[model samples]
Target chain A: MEILLQQIVNGLVQGSVYALVALGYTMVYGILGLINFAHGEVVMIGAMIALTVLQILLAAAFAPVLAVLFSLLAAMAVCMALGYGIERIAYRPLRNAPRLAPLITAIGVSIVLQNLAMMIWGREYHSFPLPFSSTSHQLGGAIVNDVQVAIVVIALLIMSALMWLVHRTRLGRAMRAVAENPAAAALMGVDINRVISATFMLGSALAAIAGFMVSANYGIVHYYMGFMLGLKAFTAAVLGGIGNLRGAMLGGVLLGLIESLGAGYIGDLTGGFLGSNYQDVFAFFVLIAVLILRPSGLLGEKLAERA
Target chain B: MSINKSALLVAFGIALAGCGKSETASNPASAPAGELVIKIGAAAPLTGPQAHIGKDNENGTRMAIDDANARGVTIGGKKAHFELLSEDDQTDPKTATIVAQKLVDAKVNGVIGHLNSGTTIPASAIYFKNGIPQISPSATAVRYTAQGYKTAFRVMSNDAQQGKALGEFAARVLGAKQIAVIDDRTAYGQGLADEFVKSAEANGAKIIVREYTTDKAVDFTAVLTSIKGKQPDLLFFGGMDPQGVPMIKQLRALGVKTQFMMGDGGYTPKLIELAGAAAEGAYASLPGVPLDNMPSGRDFAKRYEERFHQPIQLYAPYCYDAVNVMIAAMQKAGSAEPEKYLPEIGKTEMDGVTAKIAFDEKGDIKGGAVTVYQVGQGKWHAVQTMGGAPAAKP
Candidate 1:
């Protein structure tokens, strides 16, 4: 029972970051009908940029809080800029072309960003400096650390803010109109390009927070860290009903919980044939099961035409 | 316009080739009379996470070549000029095999790496088929030499020795009755863990839980928590520094308080730097004497620092020894030809920076020493040196 509680806590922390990253994929998919496959790379850029800033600040002996704050802001600002540029230069050029073109281009952009990061950061694991104490608190027999709490809380806050912006704001309405029909939205003076660009920036900013969260939570970062994470988050987005905002959150958290719980008990269930090391298999297993059983996701609304 | 750009690109490519050729041409001893240039191929992961260790090994080989040239070593009555033809295998098996073939095609007399066991095991066959000698400075998987490939050799103790020593150390010295073992499931990690478990059981320490992880994974909360429930007193991980650092951090965060131990993969300064205070009291074992404790290690470290501007990493001294041993065989056989010197290599016996360099019948370092270290005061301090003999159960 204690182990289950511990895993639940672990899953929630991991899932919140997945949900945060999934939001970027879902938002971009909803607004522009593109997967923005490079969304994961954007998250990596955010983490890497923040790490560089933090390195410099720590070297200068800046206060831990000040350094973390500045670095967080830098990561967001840089990733937002990158998102805007990526949408304009890569996705925009192929917006009216066959969807496959943009999909391939997104993949291309992801590879280019990964190699660029490798060149910039080198392909080694770097220890991420934590501004706050990593000490855990015992709560109901479960271990909870400040970093995990911060990740979960910050992710929730970002998701809430995103929910508000997407539903209650003018940009959100414009984004919704564009997602409904780009030609019609343009006729209605919705400024389709602007909405798409805004969506990318907003989504990327969320990814930036998630990037910092994951880097801080694990206390390690590397060039290729974003690839597997991005794949998982994309699966989460799809599982939540690809174009549904709330579904992405549900799917991400659900996937995390399943993975944690599954990994925790797999050895016992299998009588030691399989072990916790195969935990990653649970995420994909859930993905495949969801895709087969509920094509539109648990909360996703069925669309007559697929994006 | 396209034609002109194509022409310009061609010109640029040619100019780059010429520039490369010029540097080689500038080498003072290239094809000089009475000088037989022997190209020794070195393959390792020079570009991935393990690149630091790979480059360290390459640097060791480089130092050996420089020293050999300076000594004007002769073979078959000709002054020998050694050249290191290095390639990055990128820590991948397919790449390692390709690199091995490329080295053989380049007609290298002897080869020096393919660092990880996953890579080295596959690449060893390529060297064997071509009758070229290859020595691994860091690959410690027992299966590496067990393949019966005469071309395969290593300068350090294999995982069996290291793992048994670790298990015995934990059981006898630390007196831990309950132990939990976690491996990354790679050939090196799993093989090491299996051996550790065997010896631990033999030493009367029962392994309570055996978990597994992957090389690239950083999250261990689930696995660690599962192990925590078992309440094991000692937690051992069989993985490299990258995963070990974070695992240790997570373990401490969970407040398990289990004594942490790892194999040679976690035995690096980088691990200490990454794990921070969490690494305090953590134990790690290396397959050879600590670099500082080696006979000529101090001088080699000073020279390596002067040359590379970085302290010697884990495998540099072993690599230096491997290279010198290869050259020694060449000198003994009176030729730098692989087939001629290969037999002499098997009979190698000389003082090396890492040990008294010699190989058992299986081509593993004979009676290779294993040194167990514990992180104390922010540094890995050698606690005990277990000689080549396997630890006896007490």
Candidate 2:
């Protein structure tokens, strides 16, 4: 049905955003073996900063393209700095300590960043400026917008670039070496601290782009925007195999498609007893089902314990 | 021992007297000028997504207080000076209760507040328990006035009136046969949407699809796509401007050309700015006469704009009226105390900036007005203004 195709388009657009944010989660977890809870906050920061920059530029009568370009770059730069700071101050000290310490610290960092953003932005929903035209192109009764197209294309490009960075580069090998055995990697003259910091920077930059794209796609931004999104992205990472790069991407896109289609059809399917508002329930159900059926994730390989 | 006990009792009495004296003395309004200082606590979402509207409400209260002070209002032969104690509820119900208690503890004579129904409903209980009269500038949920709390009062029309008007308009004015309704699922949004659906159905418009979303949600593709499949002639959303803006944008982006309808929450200049070209032809219903039609509205808008450096959002004029109506009650009763003036509040008749302010027994504005607006040429033009139960659309 055309409606089904339309839902898929919508799902893919949403899925790409989730996949982008999920990559941030999986990468940090892959390299650090610790969930960087603050990564979502970085996403929030990115969106807020981008919106603020765009507003400033627009107020100054700058071209929309120039404003958007500057905004994205500013968001990336600021988020990268924030990511580095979070790692250096919050996680680095606790790297060898109990895992729970860093995890709790990451949560603390998230809360702190959220409150900080609220204080700065004044806790209001800001309408993000649409740099591109919002005109819709119809394809067989389905609608597509420039923002959606941009999100999907950019997400794929980022994922491909990330795949290459993680698999084909010398730094990529060093990152894998560090992940496999930090003690041995350091003994072999790899800068474990530098590698970990680089991973955080890379993950934060990806999240920043995701944050910017999500804001552009939604056409709105606010302080608490990242909380639910971060949770969903984390679910995607887990569903795709947390440390498995490709799995995260696959999981995120799949989750997005399922949620969109499920929400689209659930009301009619249920004789109006349930509505699309229950869409979140379906997303959570996927998480629960995935956890039950494949705890190692769809593409995750079971790693043997050290002797 | 007896002498020491007597001394202690004397000290305690002196301390009690000192407290009462200092309370009056320290209040800048009292200032030992035989002035009766009435502290009116105003609570709203002064720090959240709703802060812009909250600030508008607070500014209205401030303007009224300024006017009252300029007029040198006197009650029972005492010069009455009004002091506004503003608190931010942060748009949270729990925070609203805490803010309500804080205002009560501050011993405010009256309260004007709590922009949202969710905040106002819970906070009303606190004011009622403390015998403090509370007037909401914008809380329009029917249950707010229906709660049997004499302390609760609102200057604007409730959802029942606004929704009915919107529904009738959609059916009669737009001549829509099939309609789809969506709500943000907040107390205000759901309540307004329910009333609209009820009245729309009553007016012979068949609802094809009903969808619900949270106030924070921005993406509406799936929901709109489903609604699009049904091919409704009209789409009604019961939510604030923030959600309405994006929803409309997304709807248009998806090529759904159904005539969009919204309640007062979407009836703002900000909505136009946010939705841009997508806001064209959208219908929104705001409670009360348009500002241009009000006798004092033009002057009030000018003064408000001059003071705030921003155009008035929705509810500011009503807020201005709410404060004056409360002051009118105090003047009628010849007293500034809550217990004395609370009864007089129901009997008030004041020509305020918004309307002839008076409350029915249910604490709702008597014969509250609803104005229907259509966005034309990138501006809101009032198409109709109806009072009482709207007359079958036409």
* Per-model CA lDDT versus the true structure: 0.87, 0.86
Off by over 4 Å in 2: A55-67, A94-108, A122-124, A301-307, B1-35, B389-394
Please state how well chain A of candidate 1 matches the true chain A, as a TM-score.
0.97
Model 1 clash pairs? none
- Per-residue alpha-carbon lDDT of model 2 for B1-394, expressed as tens digits? 9999899989999997775454222236444566787888888876546777787888888888878888899888898888878888887889999989998999999999889888899999989999999999989899999989999999989999999989999998789999999998887999999999999999999988889987666677888889988999999999888778888988888888989999999998888877778899999988877788777889999999999888888888888888888888999899988999999999988777877677899899887778899998889998888765332132
Docking class of 1: medium
lDDT string for model 2 (A1-307, tens) is: 8999999999999899889999888988887889988888899999999999998999999998899999999999998899889999999989889889999999999988987897798645677886677666787777888788889999999999999998999889989998788889999999988998888889899989999998888777878788888988898898999888999999999989988999899999998888988777777888899889998799988865422
Best by DockQ: 1
Stretches of candidate 1 off by over 4 Å are B1-35, B389-394
DockQ of each: 0.58, 0.45
